[model samples]
Target chain A: MNLTGWKERLFQRYLIWSCRREKIRRYLRDSLPSLPLPDPVDRRSVRVGALQVKLELCKSPIAFADLVHRRVKEAYEAGARLVVFPEYLNLLLFGMLPGIEELEKDYSTGIAAIAKNEQQEQTDVISLPDLFRFMTPAVQPLIFTTFSALAASYHLYIMAGSYTIADQGAIVNRAYLYDPKGELIGYQDKIHLLPVEEEWKIKRGKIFNVFESALGRLAMPVCMDATYFETFRILEERGAEIVMLPIANLEAYNYWLALRGIWPRVQESLLFGVKSALVGSIAGLTFTGRAGIFAPLELTSNRDGVLAEVDCFDNEALAIADLNLDSLHELRCSHPWRDHNPALYRRYFPQVYKR
Target chain B: MLVAALSLAGVDLSSINGYISGLINLLTAQKPVVAVLPAHSALALGLGVGRLNSSNTFQEASAYYFAEGTEWTSEFLNLHGLLAKELQIYLVTGNVIEKDEDLSYQTCYCLNPAGQVCCAQRQTHLTRFEQDLHLSRGDKLDLFRVGNFYTGLVIGNDARHPEVGRIMALQGADLLLHSGAIEGDQTCWQQAAGMWAQVQQNQLYAVEAQLSATIANTVFGGNPSIIAPCETTFGNTGYLARCNPGEPLLCAELDKETLSEIRNDNPLLKLLNFDAYTEICGSEPQ
Candidate 1:
């Protein structure tokens, strides 16, 4: 290397380190408050408390209803106000497309009984394929009818991670956040598709969404979408005090790996004002249960990291953490990224997307 | 002893000697030691020896290039520095890509012993294949100095971008370490070698350490004996070490006095301006 070249490299590195040093210092000094408890609906305060998240992978569609009923009772008895299930909780019927013709006959009768809230009266003779098809058609309407009844019966919120609604032939993954009052207060469609599904031509989501719930304005990034940091960043920018990721982490080892791990740390450091929890289920072949809660940004040896992590692979477990919203608001006041020279970044990477 | 080399722009070549000697003085005196880990390629998971694919998809491929490896690499580098005692291990963040839908590369990060990223810089230019892959272009060139020792890092394809090495020199990097994977060159082997020579000329003490043959599906096979000033590259064993230019696992001690004399004699730092170049390039239509 020549004399001139060497000096140039030194100066460039200096600028970068200078920028990072400030960020690191900011992360160390500013300690955000813990999550606040859920207050009355009329109050503007953010609620942070013990919320137990459980992911139950019902092997098939036939056993799903029974599992849901039993789990609800157990979770309620254990004092869980909100419980979540994967995209197709009715897996009992999801795998049976081959016998659609035969299944449809039984499905029509069962749908009628389920619609009328007479679940016990519904015939159990229906095949899995029939049930799977039944779960697809009028998914939203039927889901409300069933989960609302369950929510009313238990007086708890069932944040169904997602269910594919057959819009014509195209299925849209949608999550329904049901209130204890049997009202569906929030709904979010899965924005990113599985790579295979993407290859199959599923329509990419047109909306980057965050919905206001009793706990906080929650942002849900479906499955693969969480891999993209923008979704989480957008949630923070849009006043989403709490970010809930309801995903099917069907990777080979049930490992969320880097996406599940490092990203939350980055978010905590830069956007110290938000508490993010990712609840994932292993539905694939090696269903090593990796379900967990990512609490607000906290100090970990000078770097910001996840306050808590739930189990990655297991049958069923609830990871709980306290997230105080008041502290988040306080941290926002002193955020460095929020005060960065926007003009400089704009001038640098002109094509960068903004939410 | 792993030495990686990269190309530099003519503008940065003027002050290269002083920068290198100053760094040597800092190392000799303050003794800030660092472990510079190269970023693994995305191919590490898709079709390489390293089992970085903890997850199933190609998306995990990005992690192979720069994720927990960044964590482990940083941690390991810190450990190396500790082993050297007074040597403070500074991690060189090779070029790192951002987590984007487009899956483009971002800034490279190097960690200090405290696990803090002490220095980081992005590759401002994209190579041919990188452009084909649609990698995002970076803006500023960066070089970091800790105590006195300074090093510029280039990861994977960034090794091929001359501006990165040059920019590092202008910013005051003493020695340039380039971490990359050189898949076997097809028929255009000579052209690639010529490119390497250009980079070496541009960045005075340029060192290019490649992952072993098994790891990278290496294409370049020039005798390391005639290549590096050091007698070894980091992490590779099976080389003839006593040769003059050295071999892989090649380690070289910089001649601080000689380097300093060169910089004093050719003090062209002010004459070659970056502002003028950027002004012209910035206005050019892409």
Candidate 2:
């Protein structure tokens, strides 16, 4: 075998050894006793929880599981039937690698270090998509099992945020949903890619899926997908009652920029929107957003469209609110979003998109 | 470039000629490259003879408000067109243009600096009030040019539909001019659903001029403002300038460089999934 082939095999083995499942399970078992007791579930309305998770680097898979388990437990204790986490949730698994914490403190230095480690002589910077592609095989299983176990153990439905993985030689950001029985419900790939993602060669997904769950018909669209109205319109047309958005915004939190997402979408689509945010910093990129649960202004008691929201942008907190399905159904029936001129749209959308 | 938005309140339809003279004087002072007036500002003149009240039926209200017909609309357009030429600025105004005897459409007219009607966009989406008045819906979306910027116009409730603004952006519009009105207090959600969200989604500069007059027993009020993409605006608030209740005029400069930067940085339109939208549009609404 060639020397380069041997080195690649060794690197793969090291990643597998670093993310071994036994350590993660041991951490989960040890952390179980410290978790809060579950609150009695309310049968009247669907209580949803959105987590504003502070970004953290873990020393191993165990530490990542501990961070995730604690948040899941807290939401369950708060009587939340369904809980959502932020985008790039599995990207936190990078924390499990040795020396990654110091490297991630600065993006340029991290890229330099990765390039040196990978022995890429042709380029000074390593491709982020390629790095994620290599890491996916080792990390994807850990992410799935951890969320599945948490969902089943808590008897709660979970939108486990999003993971960027290599699919058919293309990187795509995909969001996953787990039912109460720990079964995989379905997944929705992000339809809109941020410019940075485009730089990393992440391909945009072509389909929007509305998954049928115990709570209701739910659609999961990651971060930038919420920036476009077509995402919500398509989901609404497909009969999605609840839309879960997982955001890891790269920009500083401005109230108006934040309004560009799920807040106005709920107003436009008349669908309940649950948004989970990843806050703090990773890879020298700062993420700031408030986790929020939004409904139509008329349905909300304050008529503000925001049902519940985290108090601050950078802090970790859970925003929980009861989604009155009956009220939503009534609003939908009355408003009936039938005014969307499909005939007018059919003219421009095809020609415009064709360009 | 400097842009201005005018909100008309307590306008007496009896002396609209005096109102237009005062408006032209105000625009001359501001000297904006473009100015936007509120929806139904010109058509309100018809309401002068037969004033609307709570007792009037839909038929009564429609007849009374549209009595002036196309001849009056032509005079109104000529008035605004001459005003645009006099000020040497692009002007956008809304009027109810009668199509034959039975049909009338809520149209937004954009008059160029040359005082010529460059483009007219009819409201594709109708409000409950417009529907009750039996207003005809417009079919095509069009764009006009203001200086170097390709601009689109949306009247009243058309701003509520994201598709209108998006199609304009797709057609290479960098600026959107909206003339709309709301009965009673404008809610936060209602405001967000208009130009603010449109600017964010389309990454374009927008000027929204709202009508703030009371006709019938209903009181109309809105905050007229100039808006831009959040990243380009001061404090990232998405508003370059917003007028208060009693304030009728707002003027602000739109930075072309900043708008280009925002669009270049994000390029959201390029990422749109057209095939998926096509499939969704083809499917029946659930």
Candidate 3:
């Protein structure tokens, strides 16, 4: 192999070794806090928890685990049957790696320097997809195990947010859903990619999956997927009752832009929408949005689509609300939305989407 | 190019001509490239005698106002055509077009600067009220070229469906004109889901004109506004200009350059996965 190839292989080997399960467990043992697991929720209606988590650099895998565990525990204690975290929550594991601190520092300084119109010596900055590709092998196992353990411990269905992993040689943003038994129910890959994701060479997912669970039909679509109505429309057509969207928006919070997602999607499809957002700054990029649970305007008591939303944009908080599936089903049946012109859509959707 | 939306409140059926003349005076000052008027602004003249919620009254009023070959339809068209020609601006407005003695369609008409009908889209999705009134549904969606923009027209509740906007965007429409009349109480969420969401999702500019007058027991109320995608608007609010109470006209410049830049950067339509949607909407046409 060439010198560059050899160097790349060596770095991958180091990452794999550093991300071993035993090392992660040892780190967690030191950093994880002991908290009592709350009794399981025994309500007729399913309560959902949306975690608006602030992006933070963790010192070790244990710190990341501790952060996730605390949020999950809080949701469980609050009697949420389903808990959702924000997209790219797995990226926090970067802090545990040996060389990422320097990279993070460089990224922050580079961004600042660019903003100030100051010239600095150029350094090779790694792209997000490449970084995730190299680190996925090491981090994927830990993410799965940690979320699986949390789901089992809390006895709650957990949408473990989204992570970029190398899938069939292409890096895809994928969201996983874990059952109360800690078993992997299903996962939905993000169908739509942002402009940055396209530039970073992240491949888009091709299919939509709606998983059947105790809390009716649930589908988890990560971030940008919710921007398009087709995502929710297709899921709703497939009998998805509740749709979970985990977003880490890379911009300042704007109420109008935020409304383009779950709020209107819920109104259009007459389905319950749960949104979990990643806020604050990390690696020179700022993410700002409020996590919220949404329903149709008629279903809401106040006739506003928002059921519950995080009060602040840039801080960590949990928004919990109960979803009455029975009422939603009734609304779906009674409403005139079922009168949608399928033939009209068939004429244009196929031709338009093909273009 | 500057586009305008008109919201009419307390419209008097007795002085419909005077109302049109006043509207023309208002538009003559702004001289927008295009002006959009709300749905049923002219046809609701029949509602002066009856309640909108009464099925028998609605049916009788619709027939008398639209299907009876009344002079109001021709007069309404002539006034709008004159406005379009005199101002040299494209006029998009909604009116009930009689198809037959038994059928009348709630249609959105696009009148070009030549005072000619360029395109007409009948409301494809009818509300419960319209269905009870026995109005015929339009079968096709169409787009027309006005000035430098390809524009699409959606009437009333037709804007509620995302499919209509998506289809128009696919047909290369950069501007969507929604002419609507909201009856009874309208919530903010309902408004957000209409043209606002359409512009954001389709990455197009939209002008929503609403009728805000009360006829009998029915009260039509909404804020008319010119909307662009949030990224292109001030404060990312997605609204360029919104009509306030006592203000019927809202005018805003539709910047093609900004829209092109936003669409180029996002390219939401180009990124749509056809294979996935095909599963929900059925297989591609042979």
Candidate 4:
């Protein structure tokens, strides 16, 4: 708290910062910008085709990271300026817990803590080794490094929808939006969680957030929040041009209704204004083919007419579309639906959100 | 004849109690009252008020919100001002002023249709944010009349509380002017209901204008403006404007005659049942 103590601490912190900086420099000589990757055809002026966003339904927790890495590379090849993937992509890489013998050798200490905590709760405590019989740690950093490198290498934007990761000791569900330079520009922690999935050790987000970047303003409302039109309305009010949603859309009537039915109704309600691109996913069941783009309701951008929808029920191909930022504004100006006012009709209804 | 303009959109709390003397005076007033719909904007576009800080320039402050936020009342007033240059344009606001509550006293300006402020609303709602910070909510619901129409301004969220709308209506308000924001599809259902109530129950007009989006939800079209009738079951009809990022302006016309026909048929406004109903209700069903 004193000046001298603060000075000493500041100096020590600076030293640590420089050391970390130097270590990264040693591995990655010079800033990644100096590297000569071919220019992207200078297509910034030309309006691209329909915006196609793909969600790589990763099978294993460890596979989640690699899947994003691979799909991002594919998206770049497909010429997608923005690409999104689902929640908990990295955790899937660890695969399920490994067998008991391997768990005993590899995770005995961690498992003991789990057993002790379980016993305290008055529940049956399975040994870590026994639990490992089904799942194994996939080394999350391996996946992180791969996506980070790919983003840096390809000069693309990526929305790795909420993922469960350890920071210090807590497991948090975090969303990261990487810029064209592969720099992590925006971070939104999931504010809401699925009531059914409690084991993921996820924490709720305290704020509804938005992010600004070179492409435009973007925000992600994890999974459940996407269903709340208020979330999108607030985002639109806040100047969010595009909303990237990375959902683990499961196969249920409600989920299906959201992806197909309700989303279109929302698109119509715009009266003639606000056009936001919907890029999202449904994890686990790849069969329903849940990932795709929802726009064209307001024809500012080229009607790529749903450029691509992937078969998520299985290991499938990616959805592709060329997104044009200018077209969004242009359409808003031209469409009447965007400008209609309902108060003129003399109708007033009340809306309430229940916890 | 002098005309007074009023709009009550999405706020139902302003409905007058039938037994109250305030309700009787409001129903008997004679004026060519027209209620206009609230204006619309995008979600990211903060209302103009969000930008007015102690030191920021008006231009710099305005940039903090999307251009659409300031366009609603300013645009509509400017358009109407042009049509009736010699006629007075009385406007109403729906919520507390978004920014510069201090300036709200000076906010009302009378403009000549060219979109200049001919008149502005005094702050009607309590100091919303500054009460905890540096300001307090305004206690007075200020009133002004142009032509035969008596007008008052209440913030948009205030419309949900009927008293704000009813107070103005009771003080010989032929119409109410509302300006604020509402986000999403449910707005359609709510706005429709308000239009019906204002015309049938109040026997008056309420013009509702609103901003399209809020800071929380960024997916919406334009403000759905409605002109509610004081009679009939036609419901409210008008235009739904797109949000700034999405589309263009939507316009519609409201037939004023519907007010007369509904008033003639609906006997609920004339019948005396409050005494019996109150007595039974007050007895507590022993």
Identify the leading candidate in terms of TM-score: 2
**For candidate 2, lDDT tens digit of each residue in A194-252?**
76677677888888999987688899999999988989988888889899999998888
Q: Which of 2 and 4 is the better model by TM-score?
A: 2
Alpha-carbon RMSD of each model:
24.2, 3.6, 4.1, 19.8
DockQ for every prediction shown: 0.03, 0.55, 0.46, 0.02
- Taking all chains together, each candidate's TM-score versus the true structure is 0.44, 0.90, 0.90, 0.41
**Which structure among the candidates has the greatest DockQ?**
2
Give one digit per residue, the lDDT tens place, for model 4 in B152-217: 654543443333443454455555555544445345434432332333334555445544433332
- Model 1 DockQ class: incorrect
Task: Name the lDDT value of residue B256 in candidate 1.
Answer: 38
Taking chain B only, the TM-score of every model is: 0.56, 0.89, 0.88, 0.49
lDDT of 2 at A326: 78
**Candidate 4, superposed: residue stretches over 4 Å from native:** A1-67, A100-140, A166-170, A198-201, A252-289, A300-307, A311-313, A333-335, A338-355, B1-286
Spell out the clash pairs found in candidate 3: none
Full ranking by DockQ: 2, 3, 1, 4
Model 1 TM? 0.44
What is candidate 4's lDDT per residue for A32-125, written digit by digit as tens?
Answer: 3343554453323321112223333333333444454555666666766666766555434333223323433333344444423233233233
Local distance difference test, per candidate?
A: 0.42, 0.79, 0.79, 0.40
DockQ of 4: 0.02
